[model samples]
Target: MRSDLQIQQDVQDELQWDAILKAAEIGVSVKNGIVTLSGTVDSYSKKIAAEEAVKRVKDVRAVAVDLAVVFPGTIDHKSDSSLASVALDALKWTSFVPEERIHLQVDNGNITLEGELEWQYQRDAAFNAVKNLQGVRSVINKLRIKPGPSAHIIKDNIWKALTRDANIEAKNIIVETRDRTIVLKGKVRSWSERSDVERAVWSTPGVLAVQDELTVSL
Candidate 1:
């Protein structure tokens, strides 16, 4: 196991390596295996990028993102109405997002997406559409997946998918289904693999939510 100080240094280095983030704008601290990122970034996308960078470092157990988005003075801030219009346009252009079924609200540059879609990927696509908008400070995704038929088969399908995935050791994982939600319990070799397992679970047709209880065996 890596020490807290080593994890902190690697996280900082990882943030510095990411091209989208200004490394100096983010502060890194590690306690045990948990990393806390604080400071301010110019865009919401960069804030997401910083957290992702920390996740990529070896031995990082979990991440707490406390970064704030503060746009530079030179960039003109858009009024809430204008930001809403721009976000609508962006959603309309995203092919994966079903804009007709989704409703959004923009308040002081923070965007909230609320509606229901058939798949988790569509909900994710809708969030991605507005997160990079120039004036967006944060995005809250309240979008939900419409429940699919035959909940009985969800667990089996997810297990098959997990077994087929090259990155996951399916034998080490247990898949449990409660209605439309998947509860994953097991151990994964790394943070990335844990994410991979969750992503696979979400891609299944009947899955509406995932409760990931998988621990990384560092």
Candidate 2:
């Protein structure tokens, strides 16, 4: 196991390595295996980038992001209405996002997405549609996934996908379903494999939610 100080140093280095983030504007701290990132970035995308960078580091068990988005004065500030229009337009252009089913609200550069969609990917698409807008400070995804298919079918499909993916060790994993929700339990060798397992579960047609109980043994 890596020491907290070592984890902190690795997270800071990872942040510096990510081209999207200004490393000097971010503060990194670690407690046990949890990494907390604080400071400010110019865009919500950068904030997310910093978190991803930290997650890529070894021995990191969790991340708490406290970064704020502060746009520089050089850029023209957009009114809430203008930002809403642009966000809506972006959603309309995104083929995967059902703009009609999703509703958007912008308040002080914070975008909120609320509504319902049939698949987890569609809900994710709606958030991606507005996350990088010029004045967006943060995105709040309140979009719910509409339940689809039966629990048994959903669980079976997830198991098939997990077993088929060479990156995941399906035998070590257990799949349970509560309605449209997938409950994953077991262990994986690394965070990447854990993510792969979760991704596979989300891609199943009827999954509305996932309870990821897998632990990283490495």
TM-score of 2: 0.94
Candidate 2: lDDT of 201? 90
lDDT for position 117 in model 1:
92
Give the number of the best model, judged by TM-score: 1
List per-candidate RMSD values in Å.
1.0, 1.5
> Best by lDDT, which number?
1
**How well is each residue in 1-218 modelled by candidate 2, as lDDT tens digits?**
98999989988888888877889989998998988999889999999888889878898888899998899989998999999999999999999998999888888999989998988788888888888889999999989888788998888889899999999999999999887878889888777888899889988887888899988775
Candidate 1 is scored at a TM of 0.97
**Candidate 2: where are CA atoms >4 Å away?**
none
Residue pairs clashing, model 1 = none
Q: Go through the candidates in order and give each one's C-alpha lDDT.
A: 0.90, 0.89
Q: Model 1, 98: alpha-carbon shift in Å?
A: 1.4
Task: Quantify how close model 1 is to the true structure by its C-alpha RMSD in Å.
Answer: 1.0
Off by over 4 Å in 1: none
